[model samples]
Target: MSDDVSLMLRASRGDRKAFRSLVERHQQSVYNFFLRTTGHPEDAEDLTQQLFINLYRSAGRYKPTASFRTFMYRIASNLAVSFARSRHRRDGVSLDQMLDEGREPPRHRLHDDPAAGAEWSELEEAYLAALAELPADWRTAVELRVGRQLSYKEIAQVMGKSVSAVESILFRARERLAEKLEPFKE
Candidate 1:
């Protein structure tokens, strides 16, 4: 059994420490997923908290048929989609809000040179703008595959689609992203 599954089993048996361990292990990755997916720090924080809360509540229902990482991401993906839908209904803002909001989305800085940093920042902004333009399903697939490094099968499981469907979504998403980023390549 995986370490996460073992922790979850212990958690389901009322081990608070086990549950806390699971949370500590997975929280940052989950937060990063939500942060990139939602493009808002506050929403990402809320969703991360909610994801763990739900996980604790549903611990009894967890089975080891899938890896715990996949299960956790499945929960995160559902929450993200629901959050996006409700936000769309309530705010009706263009997805470009991710890029045009005057604040940069959180990212690790890898360069110390001012020129390199500015160029990298610009590229990151452009990429995010292009990503926001993708259809929701395609974006989720791409994010799961590229951002989280899930296998196609794992992504399909998370998205509740067949592997072929996941493949098509990824193919289209990559094509669209390439088109959008082509100008930036020069």
Candidate 2:
């Protein structure tokens, strides 16, 4: 078994140290996943804590049918949906509004140079804006495939969809992004 799998198996037997080890090993990845998907650091921290709490509560039920990451992200995917639904109901902000209005996307540099200038900043903003325009599930799929570097099969596992479904989602997401970013092409 992988070390992560071993840790989880030990955790199932009520090994708190093993569980803490697992949490320490994986927490940053999970936090980055939430931050990328949600674009909110505070929300990301909350969701990361909630994910570990859920994992601890359900450790006894964890089966080693897949990789530890696949299992963790499966749980993460489900939590993201639940959190979005609850936040929407409580705050009354529609997904479209949330994606398009007020909030800035989580910034990723478009150029390596710190002084890449206003042109680079505009391009970066356009890219993030186009990314935010994707449907949440499609966005998540793209993030898994491109941002997290998961294989299509692994993405299928995390997303609870077939591999081909992941392919289609990513294909469509890419097409939409290309269309949205076409104006910036030189």
lDDT of each: 0.78, 0.76
Q: After superposition, how far is residue 107 of candidate 1 from its true place, in Å?
A: 11
What is the C-alpha lDDT profile of model 2 across 1-186, one tens digit per residue? 899999999998999999999999988888877766665667778999999998988888889876888888888888776676576422334334544675544344333354653445545665766665566788788878887788999999898899999989999999988886666567
RMSD for each of the candidates: 4.9, 5.1
Which segments of candidate 1 are over 4 A away from where they belong?
A: 89-119
RMSD of 2: 5.1
Worst 10 residues of 1 by lDDT: 103-112
Tens digits of per-residue lDDT for model 1, 1-186: 989999999998889999999999998889878766776667888999999999998889999886898888889889988887777532344334644676444332223345664655555766776676666677777888888999999998988999999999999988988876665565
lDDT of 1 at 54: 92
Candidate 1's error at 59, in angstroms?
A: 0.6
The candidate that wins on lDDT is 1
TM per candidate comes to 0.82, 0.80
**Candidate 2 Cα misplacement greater than 4 A, ranges:** 88-120
